[model samples]
Target: MNKYVLSLLCVSSMSFAATPFIYHDFDEAMQIRNYPKAFALTNRILNYDGKQFFELGRSLYNQYNPSVLPSRSEPIIPKHIHQIWIGGPLPEVFKKYIDTWKQMHPDWGYTLWTDENVRELFPLHNQSYYDESEGMGVKSDLLKWEIIYRFGGVYVDVDYECLQPLDELHHLYDFYTAYQPLDAFFVQLGAALYAAHPEHLILKHCIETIQDDWHHKGAPKKSGPCHFSKSFMAVAGENGSRDIAFPSFYFYPLGSKERVLRRSQWVREGAYAIHHWAMSWMPINTRRQEFRTFENERSSKVWND
Candidate 1:
């Protein structure tokens, strides 16, 4: 047989020998270049394992299964907020938006780390991962995980606008993030906005996974959501008691197209913040014209208002 066919056979056999439910679908999806679908299936399997363990833990600890406990009933916002800018000075619009958040939560502490600061702060062993990132955007994305892991807090993309005090939602879980579904088979937990306590294993795993597995291929999403999603699933599978998933609408109320169109009306009441989809750090080209236009419009709205 041809080399390609032989490789496929070997991959299929290896997948079959591993966890049947876990790796089979993932391998199939990978073969077809349906990375998103593969990731989604992996996440689903991991979540299932998490839920199972959670149920068992509750039964053993509480002497009753609290399987139906509401995940979002309580708010548990952490005391810290982190934002990063790798290139240079924080833009005027982002500054204004952050100022608004400060006005609403005067007691909370905020830190804006620069590229140099991030490089200085991150662990030395992981420097290669940071350096190998596709661009500043992916580098920034990778840094956020380390920041949140080292110091428990809410990490928000500068492009997002805070609508209210996040403390209420923060109190809900020890580690929390929302899913950004690209399609039925591809659901990604956004790194755009997430909250985690210090030494959270998932955050550590994400950092290490990026360091070990990042191959300098694919889009920024690969290093960001795709990597984060898979790491999260692995963590959830290992420890199942925490609430790791949040509905997408909480952070990303509007879809990618609507975000660019500036459809403010589509903002759901349940949304805690709005991701303006600022692809500002993205490479400039004709296809990204919409990103540029929306960014200009958003800047105007934030600065002029």
Candidate 2:
């Protein structure tokens, strides 16, 4: 398997009070600008395979059983937001996008995980993957799990713009995630933006899903949103859900009809955040140009099939 290409299995580890850490005035020089160069033809082929969602879902379901997690709900989740960057210095626009996050939620704590200190999050066994893994998308997917399981807060991509304080949404669920599009329903979950309380079973299962498949699969695909949906749906079935899945309007305005950011600065009422669809994980060449079209193909497979 080409370590440079981001595989679909999103995996992670939990060792101690020493899993990865984040927050506080992070580095100004963040590699958060554009994605890197072209991927090998072989790697590209592997990534495209995950478009088969039903097969992936069934495979994941067979591997994992639902967890009867504790009856924990919102407000229990920490008022923290975790974002990660693992490449060259970030673009100036990103700084502004993140700063808006701070301005909107003065009460919430913010953490920016970056390469300068990424090793601080993973364990010894996974360190080799970290060193060898080439795609920032893969690394970011791994980092989000650690942060969610350890810190218990909201996680967003650098491109997400905060419209209002997240207090209303964060204080409602123990392991809540945003859907991709209301029209498609449970077709896909936005892996990049989700919330969880520390130690939630769904998050652990997410970690396990990635770890179990990491050897054969690349992450940010196999281990990302699709993996998360399996864990979430399984757990929701085992234990009645509690404000667990939210509509796209909550955190995914860009993917929905009310693309407020594109038409006008004002979003429809009740929207809290907007993902600008800044696909930093995409290969910087022709593959990136096909980013939206590729993602659209995901709709062909839904949660049921």
Per TM-score, the best of the predicted structures is: 1
TM-scores for all candidates?
0.65, 0.64
Give the alpha carbon lDDT tens digit for every residue of 112-161 in model 2: 88767767776833455555566666666767877788879989888776
Question: Residue 190 of candidate 1: its Cα lDDT?
Answer: 72
Q: Tell me, by lDDT, which candidate is best.
A: 1
Clashes of 2: 18
| lDDT tens digits by residue: candidate 1, 1-305 | 85533543333333221121111121222122433343446346433342333233223223211132333554444578898876656666465456545655678899888856676685634677666544566667777888888878889888766654566545546676666533334455677888888878888888777754454354343467667776766665245535445545555655554424332332223345567666665533422343454232322222211
- Model 2 bad stretches (over 4 Å): 1-74, 124-128, 182-186, 215-220, 237-243, 256-266, 285-305
